[model samples]
Target: MEPENTTQNKPRGRVVMLVDNGVKGDSRVQKAARSAADAGWDVVLFGVSPDGEKHSWKVGSAEVRLIPKPGPLNPRRHDMRRPLFRRPLAYRSPQVARYRVQAVKAWRSDLSFRQAAVKAARAGHPGRSAGGSKARLLVPRVSSKVYSKWVALRARETTDLQQRRSMLDARLDRATTALWQGLMKQRSWRRLTPNLWDFELAFAKHIDKLKPDLIHAHDFKMLGVGARAAVRARAAGRPVKLVWDAHEYVPGLPPRHGRWLPGHVAWEKEHAVFADAVITVSPALAELLKKGHGLSQLPTVVLNAPVLSPGPDEVAGAGPVPDLRELCGVGPNTPLLAYVGGINPVRGVETIVEGLTQLPDVHVAMVSVPPGKPYAATATIRKLVDKLGVGDRVHFLPFVPHWQVAEFVAPADAAVSPLHHLANHELALSNKFFEYSQARLPQIVSDIRTMSEMVRSTGQGEVFRAQDTDDYVRAVKAVLADPERYRAAYDKPGLLEKWTWEAQAEILDGIYSRLLPDRPRIAAQPSGSRADARA
Candidate 1:
């Protein structure tokens, strides 16, 4: 679809979408922003920039304003000597001390066990005492020398290892310090949060300036941000409406290394009550939010589907499209399996690479963007491909724009969504499910509840046991064996239409209309139309 025309008459009211992450590849936020804009609301998307650069740009009728997070908040820019000060005082509270102590004790116990085992092995056989007296005495002296020498060598090795570790630690500290000093010199601290209080304080000030009619928070973290902003706006007599758009089952999200799930769930629950309305991405997630938060009503389910065009030929764009066959240097008849979105661990991307080993003839095209930080799976996947000897069959494509994703998938024989059966993935109905349907390409989805149900009900594709390499291989092979049968499923009347953003957009519009009944609705203008009526 085309970007919304900004030259139309002035929007009736303004909406501010608060998100924690950058807006580059966020399809859900983009869709919501465009839907609101199409329905006559001026949209301002407030998000964090990746490079910590504050900037603003217009995307159709929406204006994206990004805030650069402060260096103190980023671990890469941490001053090792002063890192403790960067954490919020509340995070260093006594309650957190218990977890830290437990972790430290566990690590110490493991290290002690390893050292004890090494010492015991060096000491040697206990049964040697049963030998003859002379043999024992003579052996003990010789053994003592050997043991002493071995122990000395081990001590020297230990000292060397400790010295190396200390040197590495010092180097890391210096690097962190340099980065922190550089960021501080740039004066970007003004945009950053020294602590949670500072972040909320800055966010409130930014929200106050926008004076939005409604604050649409994208996820649980932003719910707090939006609620705080709403309070500030109301105190200033703006009285903005708050809408919590929960993209995942926050409480059920799989635990990560440093994440505090309980605290996040409690925070979301506390602030969710303040929202005028709550909406989620799936029916299952909506139910979970209602019960989890003890809400009086269930959240509206707005599936993450692509915008459907009138026909397959009208998907989007008329420009020169990149050919997957030419890009991969493969023949046209070669079976291509396309996987799109972020190549993250939880997405079961490893299974895809492993499954490709079983199917030598099938070429896998991963159309994805690189994930941030140490969590980047593209490097890992590439290493796996080389190790498994599937480098010739696997191809990695640079990030395709959301609008042009179809172009990449169109040439492929089938699309795959092999999400692991985590609580969040189990309930999620991802955009790829519908994107493949819109392109009339068959899908091979993991046997998660929501996505599996969609695939089964629509008869669009096949489902495989999630995280099972054999099952994924079998599923893809089955589709590739009979591609025509699965492709015809999309040809069914009203199937693709029901899964489009246009359908979800109506539900989103209805929620907004009820929330702001007094707000006038302007007729949508044609693309590139002049604002003659307003002029």
Candidate 2:
């Protein structure tokens, strides 16, 4: 079936979005694609595939093109063994030992295949002696098993050493991170640039073929990609526009080796000059991008709010929706605290798990989508839950579709955001905050500027000291103590209308309309509205 929002008539224009991550879990990219499609634009999304296989499929109103990376480097063909040889011998973790065993098996398999090919080629050659060919084949047959055993032993030793070093490095990560951050501050910003992965390079080449009228870069990583592609297209006489959607404060991102925040900030400053327009999720971040990047224009703020319900009754009656509670085997009266987002370290998931130990009556259902990195914080949180003996109180639900998130969360007594006070978290206005409002559920948020202001102004919930387990417990209890007072805040006239994505999407629609003034105009629709629910 044709995806929702896609027109039977010819599209007004084409827009290609460059998303570094896959399209499945990225709500921002999904929203952008839907918005563009609703406005009569044919949308194409370029993203990564886990396996090295190229493929295309329809996702809602957009065409998704996924490019995969090459498989692991072969030790025989490349310098992969050089690094292994350099490591000092030491004890190995069980995980590392198993990996080394697999690597050795693969290496031996490759060697066996090569030897078989050589033997086959000798049989076909006219000049080779039968005796000499038999000897060559016999030599490998006799020594191959011994050689494979020797290689396996060496791999185990090397992997053991690497695993030991990894353990040591983990202990010193904090000190090393601080030292690296200090060194990065002194280095020339010009020297820092994002290393383009093979898939990204392939994506850039693929984009050249599309020659889209507009290019929408999802986050900082794709800013340069989109800008460069637009420049190439414009140089070829195609009038292409570039839109940068800065999802977070790039300059204030957590410190890491090589790709420091300052370096990324500097790189983005240079690339922003190429963008025809800039877009961001929150007003606080928009202002930061304007001042930090020195953009000619202030970025339009497209808040990641929940889409509006069909009517007031839908919002009010959502609380009684039958979901999660029965599936999780929790009582109807049990105070269910819902947290819907990526379960990452910065989001303070550990604190939430820890705090649940103190709140015996309340249950927390973590409806988590995967973060940028696979299982970045989920493993740690699981370990903590087991250690704290709070497994019964803390439930984990697999990520649901964007439209179905409301149904899952609607049954909760309250929504929680115990995010740590990192630079990005402090200035952040996350989707969960508005989602709680949309579900008419009270919020329990971190005592940060943006979310605190939201709760205080709207009178929808309570905020406590960020990263403090006791404070979080108290804040959640305070809200649950008088649920009606907090619930009444969401019922205030016009509050839900303001927080809905239907209102927020208008800003996005306006930005595109202004960017392509000559294109045909279509009435903008909310992403995942009834007509587009099939997405």
Q: Candidates' lDDT values, in order?
A: 0.71, 0.71
TM values, all candidates: 0.71, 0.73
Model 2 TM-score, all chains together:
0.73
Q: Where does candidate 2 stray beyond 4 Å?
A: 1-11, 69-194, 197-200, 259-263, 308-322, 369-383, 524-535
Error of 1 at 265 (Å): 1.3
- Taking all chains together, the TM-score of candidate 1 against the true structure is 0.71
Model 1, span 1-535: residue lDDT tens: 1233333345567788988888866878877886677677878888887786777775556778878766444332222232243222222233344454455556445444544555555579343323334443455445555644554454444444334434324555445534643555322222222333334654666777767889999997788889888887778787689999999887677543122343355567657888999999888888888887789998999888875432122233544456777887878799988888778788888998899778989998887755444336678888999999999888887655455566557888999999987898888888887777776889999999988997898788999999899988889889999999988888888877778787898888888878888876656532343221101
Q: Provide the lDDT at 305 for model 2.
A: 79
RMSD of 2: 8.7
Candidate 1 achieves a global lDDT of 0.71
